[model samples]
Structures are given as structure tokens and as C-alpha cells.
Target: MGSLTLSGRTALVTGAGRGIGRAIAIRLAGEGALVTVHYGRNTKAADEVVTAIRAAGGSAFALRAELGEPGDVEALWDGYDRQVVEHTDDTGLDILVNNAGINVRCAIGDTSPETFDEMFAVNVRAPFFVAQRALERMRDGGRIVNVSSGAARMAFPEITAYSMTKGAIDTFSRTLAQALGPRGITVNSVSPGIVDTDINAAWLRGDEEVRQAAAEVSALGRIGRPEDVADVVAFLTSDAARWVTGQVIDASGGSRL
Candidate 1:
């Protein structure tokens, strides 16, 4: 329905069942990319996304794989491969968005070893392996966008472990871009701040004071919408960003500026 900049391309977006990932999947489909919507366990939600895309005259399919679990990456690819063959008669990917992650609201003092490990496994290990597998199926000029967070740059004691994981992702994006440059693949990370999604609903919704406080953190003086970050990701995946790689684009509405 838009410019169709990514027409005929194939994309896979992890954690696409809801939130920012959902928005990214839809946006990519709108741009004319056949999208694979990866979900952890929400079959209904994932199906809804695919249906929405199809209803909009775009192509999409849902894949289920719980990230951070054993053999998760392999399972995800297996499903993707099957779908690709069925839909496009090909096996290579044009875009991969590592957007699935979990947050643990705990300071160092309150963080246990189990908590730390789980956070890293889901937030860091999952994306690392997912990308590793994706590269095998990615075209030479493919795009890889890792979803990081502004917490990685700021001192967010409330989510210390979560921030640490995002730091690792930022490093991964930069280093991977250097390694994949020769192959014409561009890798980048996006950092969003205080987005208004179900993930933040518990703290940001139904409370005017809390909502205003969060909005005030950004120079824009308003909370971010999922589409805000989704648009940035859409840009990075397009040919317009062919020369932009190994960078972390802040989609935080100037938070902490």
C-alpha cells in the first residue's frame, strides 16, 4: 500500500506476535516484503498478524519457536525454510529483525544468578544464534536489524541485567556489520525508549502521573508509539539505508537529551 520499497523481498521478524515486533512485521509487509512472523507461544496473536497482513493485500505467515530454549534457532529456521519454499520457491532471506527480548525488573542487589542467566539467554544468546542461522539463509545484500534499548546506554538500575544484555547486542551489531561488510550485508541496532506498548502497559497505562513522568523523559515531551520505532526499522531494512551500517540508530524520541 506504500512505496513498496522492499517489493519481492523476504523478511523474518522475531517476537512478532505483539508490541513493536508486531508493528515491524506489518510495516515490512506493507512495504511489499513477504514476512515471517515469529512468535514464542501465542498462536492466536501470531495468526492475527498474518491475517491482518493478508487482509491488507500483503503476504505473511506465522512461525512459532520459543527463543532461548534448546534448539530454538534450528527449529525457527526449519519452519522458515518450509514456508519460504511453499510461498516463494526460494530459501534465502532478505531481512532479519531480532526483536524478541525479555526484561527483568531488578537491581544488582535483587538480581539472582538464575535471573541474570535467563535474561542473557533470552536477550543475548537467542539473537546471537538466530542471527548466526539467519546469515546462512540471508542474501548477500541482506539487512539485519537488532532491536536494542536506550537502557543499554543509560544507567537504568531498575533493569541492570536487561541493560547489560542490550549492550551485548549493540556490540554484536557493530562487529557483525564489520564481518559481513564484504558480503554486502548491513547490520545495525535500534534503541527505543518508553514506548507505549503492552509491554509497558502495567506501568504506563491508566495512570496519568506515571504516564506524564515517562513522557517527560524524552525531549519530545510525549510517549513513543510502536509505529515510531517500526518506521525507523522499516527505513533500515530498505535500500535507502544501503550505506548505513554498524550503527545504533536511536529511536527514542530524543530521550535523555
Candidate 2:
């Protein structure tokens, strides 16, 4: 490969205040794209990302939005339109990484309507709306990457509802891929396995027995990291992956088969 340069493009990454979203935002910014770092809460964390990106000599700005709210999501894009014009030469989004999501660890029997609704609102509905609006501004040959999970494929206990949303994202990616292919855009999903993110630190790090069991099941003999999954996402969003679309690649280190 010569180089995967994104010098003139712009990308918006939601839930980019920390963890996998943070890593993906940084990775995209590192490739030379001006980035809009979106967060739901914790402006501090989002600013930290802005500081880190700026300190690394990359262009980035922190923007906030409550993903489940329609107005907030609209402000996210509206803010992006103004930010790009104010900060960078580009005026449109070339990449949309729908990484903002929530996980409700509720089993089938214990699942509540409120819990299920909240999860879907953040994980499924929000991303759908984001993509819908983004399409209007995205140029030809745009890229859309939805962060999915291995749970979507496996029948894991206590996470059935969360898994349902992930499966929905995968299907959405596929359909969007076909719908946008004519426009020279690519849509895909990156389904990460049990990665060592703050969201799962309790089971992946806090419990030694569970940690060991997780590692043993993985071919890599260790837990995955934010960067591990981010690397795959970066590739999918790059020119090298131009021919790849509607595909879900597992960045799980061989977990969940």
C-alpha cells in the first residue's frame, strides 16, 4: 500500500468522547481528515479528545448531543455544517461512523419495556436518523461504518435485547450499502468481539475468572482493545476498502467462532 491519506475529507464520529469511538476518531483524524468529535455527555471527555487530536497536529472539534433526542441529533449535523465551514476548507461529510450506542444487559425474561426502548433509541433509531440526514450532505463516494457486535451473531444470555439492536445495525448497513452503491458510496458494519472497553471492564478486567475464560475462548489468547477494533474500521473506511461493502468483518480475535 502506498498511503491511505484523507487530507481533504471530513468525518463525523459519534460517541467519540472515549473508548472505541475515541480511538476511531483519532485514527480518522490522524489520516488527515478534519473531524467532528461527537459526544452524548461528558463534555470533558469530548474536550479531552479534541485536545489530544489538536496536540497531535490534527484538526478536530468536540460537539455534544443526546443521541436519543431528535433535536440533539439534528444539532449534531447542523453543528457539523457550521464547524466545517468555520474550521476546515471542506463543507461536507465524507464519512459517517455511527458509533454512538448503548448496551442494556437485560435477558429475555428480565427485559423491561423502558430498558428495551432506551437501548433501541440510542443504538438503532439514532444511527438510522444520523445516516438519513448525513446522506443529504455526504458527497458521492461517501463512507458509512456502523459499529456492531459479535453478540448480534451469537445467542448470548442476558444480552438478547442488545444483540437484537446489533443485528439491526448489520441489516441496516447491508441495505444502505445497496441503496448508496449507485452513488459510489460504501456502507459496512464492523462487529467487534468482547473488547476491553470501559463498558465491559467489570467483566473483562474486574473478574479474574471471567477474564481468563474470555481470553481462553479467543484465538489471540487475550482480550481485544479499542485500537484492535479501530484498526479494522479504519481499513473499511479507506480507499483500499472501496471494493468492499455490505460486509460485516469480525474484529473479535476469533471469539464467538
Give each model a TM-score: 0.97, 0.97
- Given candidate 1, what's the lDDT at residue 248? 97
- Candidate 1 wrongly placed segments (more than 4 Å): 1-4
What C-alpha lDDT values do all the predictions have? 0.94, 0.89
lDDT of 1 by residue, 1-257 (tens): 23339999999999999999999999999999999999999999999999999999999999999998899999999999887788897999999999999986889999999999998988999999999999888999999999999998988898999999999999999999999999999999999999998888887898999999999999999999989999999999998898999999999999998
Top TM-score model? 1
Backbone clashes in candidate 2 total 0
| Quality of model 2 by C-alpha lDDT | 0.89
